[model samples]
Target chain A: MEEGDRLHLGSATLRSRLIHGTGKFPSAELLAQAIAASEAEMITLAVRRLHLDGDRRSELEGLDLSRYHLLPNTAGARSAEEAIRLAHLARAAGLSDFIKVEVVGHEATLLPDPLATFEATSRLVAEGYTVLPYTSDDVALALRLAEAGAAAVMPGAAPIGSTLGVLNPHNIRLIIQECPVPVIVDAGLGSPSDALRVMEWGAAGVLVNTGIARAKDPVGMARAFAAAVEVGRLAHRAGLAGESGEARHGYGASSPTAGLPVG
Target chain B: MTVGDLEVEAALGPEQLRTRLRASRLYVVTDDLTPLEKLPDLVQAAVAGGADLVQLRRKREPWAELVELARSLQEICRRGGGIFLVNDHVDLALAAQADGVHLGQGDVAVQEARERLGDRPLIGLSTHTPDQALKAQLLPLDYIAAGPVRATPTKPDSVEVGFQQVTAAALVSRVPVVAIGGLDEGASAIEAGADLVAVVRAVCAAPDPRLAASKLRQEAAAATPWRWIRLNGEPRKSPPGETVLELLARLGVEPAGVAVEVDGRIVPRERLAAELVSEGSALEVVHFVGGG
Candidate 1:
């Protein structure tokens, strides 16, 4: 696989261009059906301390995990210490290497704390886990996380779940340019066009959950998102039309009427 | 039985009327006392700007002239895909088969109007005091207009009810109460919890009625779901498979002040729904991102 083309997580090489997260489904059965229909290679699962009695299982007890590489997230953690503790608990729950580190500072916006995120990433990386820190679109913060041994730096395009579409494209582009680790544009996505936009910005992969899970038809939206992600990735690799100011005789090469005589 | 029959009745309550007017961008006041000849153009202008509800307030005109003016406004509203409401004129409302009628205290009695118009046409009543509001509830009212909230030039003779009356009416009334009279700015009236806002000269005389109406809608959205995400990480349940955009639409959350995040990543708001939701993943919804 080419350097810019491949999306890798530790040893796993996912074939599907899209990643899926399971939330907002009406029922577990519906969620499973939606996931199966999406044909996504990787899926995210949230892990927290179980409150149930001995050997208690999750609602996803009946789900078949054999096909999916469960990427457990430390979603509820707010501080670096809390995230590190949750990461350890996730490992105890058999989600050791693949940990989605989410350290939120504010309760309302759920904005990832960049400071806590890098701190947790550094600690986790030193502890020998493949850490993926969810941070903001701050290019400097993303670079710092990469240096902290984060396998991937997931920078948000907008606040989590606003679905406003990519609010800052330039920052994401800069992060992809300066960071050595793979850049995954995550969060604030509302539509397929947004997924395509980030991929066109040269993100290694795009991870989505709410946009699909919250749709009126999760399965159909999944298919639409898959197509968008593929088109965006392909267009990125094909080389896109660079944004230029003076309308360069841009249409001359592509338009048949360019060579034809005009009155 | 048809959508129109249900809609005509449904547009009675503030909630129902606001939902119906979701696509309408116009703001017009028939009470302007603009001559019948000039009224059609003004109504058309508001409609052109997307005003879907035009009320014919004929306080200055006598009964005969008011009825004649209503028929003309009704024609304009028809072309505009809007509702023509007669302010304080049950007889003209019945004559026009107007989408509904809005009545003040001295107009026709609520029971008499309902008998004349039947259960189909929407009926809205104006209440200035809490006692009047409580009495309105006993009568069959689709919605209540609480105000004269601020002092405005539209009704120079009308008393200013202040924000307290509006809030009292909202708290006491069983039906949806729209704050009327002088709702010039968004912060005060909306923060007071008025369901649908009604402005006369403020909206009608504005340079751009569409933008004026949009500003009110923005205000209403801001005041609602005030705390978008309440407390720690408890996911505000969005219906499964809705794009954050679609979810917002379903929840009646305005397009602004809401964001979508998936898999610990901020999916550009555009791509959130373009990608599908994986089963059993966490989805967080936040609203009212801006302002004090």
Candidate 2:
């Protein structure tokens, strides 16, 4: 498919293969420019403080926006309740429909709390949010998340910020098999090859931040990611020949169709 | 040339912008006029009419001329209780210490401005299409100028993006949207759901800028027809385990007029009785603030 092809959620389909985040950029201006250059369709943001119109010192200060769909994430929230509350605030501030539900139990590892992750996903789904839960590569937990009405499941290949590549490939592969919704591998992807590896294992997409953010050049990194995702997905569609002990067929006009129709 | 705070503009952050947004309607200053000897008078008039934010827009002028003009206007706008913004001049904006800078599509990118300016001042971008608006969401823009409600005299080269595009832009934009372009009659912009109505001759060359601004404010106020009401009954604080109707009963308000929106979706009336609620779930029981 082309870059503008729709990515289907439960009922909603998004255009654009790339999803960019709003943190860690030196400035908002660069963030906007990078997004434009990357041709991204979706962008994620976090709310640090309540922003009422006319306030001059808020975190949202100086960013001029009269258009664009904002997807607010529960980035720092530890519990399901906090994540839910954050989602509400995001709605009040004008980002209502879409939310990324993230629950971190251990702040040190920043690994998702599987139990709390499922709880939050379940509640958010019941409340009618298109919940995309981020968690460890636990097949059972992945199944539970989907059962909870999650639109998609995001299983990390490695700890966030680790950039160790896919550590739990077998588990991730298992989760992919068990999931009904799209299985997106998020966090711990160190490079474009890692992202491609996860997609090779049947992950529908990947949500990358630190990998791109920490790169020497962020804009160039974003372009690389876009290409990597495209090539990986295309490779999957093209299908690679599997290795086997069976003898290989000789290359020649062995088939009668090649020499054809002498009659 | 416009006189506003470069440090305060630098210090002027997103929190400040949000507060200002909630507190007042954003004002799109006329870009056609130059160093108004009576800038304070012009801004004072706008304040009297409830315009809180002012954008100083001047196109295609020499860099030095733009700076000189921006410096003067910024000071007057600041004294007049408004935030001043320079149009499409990041370098000049930083030099003049203007509260913020607004960039056209062809101007510097948002990230470049952020790098140069840091988190100190507000940044604005001009968008004419939905694609541009979507891209704008990824940047840290405080708000968007949804333009040219009509064919504007200030920018004859730009195409007019009628009110329909304006409303659509407002609904999809991640940040607040201000309608610009030929909004001589402020009511039209407000009716089209513009958070701000930007004009040129209407306020710049008016015989009485204050009156012109006040008239625009009045029209905007009149046009903002959102229905608001205080529920006669108190809303129940959602408990860890409670259904929508149970919560309504606890609050003693009939669940008839009040509709429940959990998370972001509206819960069906039939499901309200059995739908168990949880902490952090947002349950808004909305009733009509006005109806015959």
Best by TM-score: 2
Candidate 1 chain B, run of 10 with poorest lDDT: B225-234
In model 1, state the lDDT of residue A81. Answer: 85
Worst 10 residues of 2 chain B by lDDT: B226-235
Per-candidate interface C-alpha RMSD? 16.4, 13.5
* lDDT by residue (tens digit), candidate 2, A128-186: 88777888888998888888888888888888778788998889989977799888788
- Show where candidate 1 strays beyond 4 Å: A1-5, A51-57, A243-253, A256-259, B1-292
What docking grade does candidate 1 earn?
Answer: incorrect
Cα lDDT tens digits, model 2, B61-100, are 6877667767766765665567778778788888778888
Candidate 1 chain A — worst ten consecutive residues by lDDT sum?
A49-58
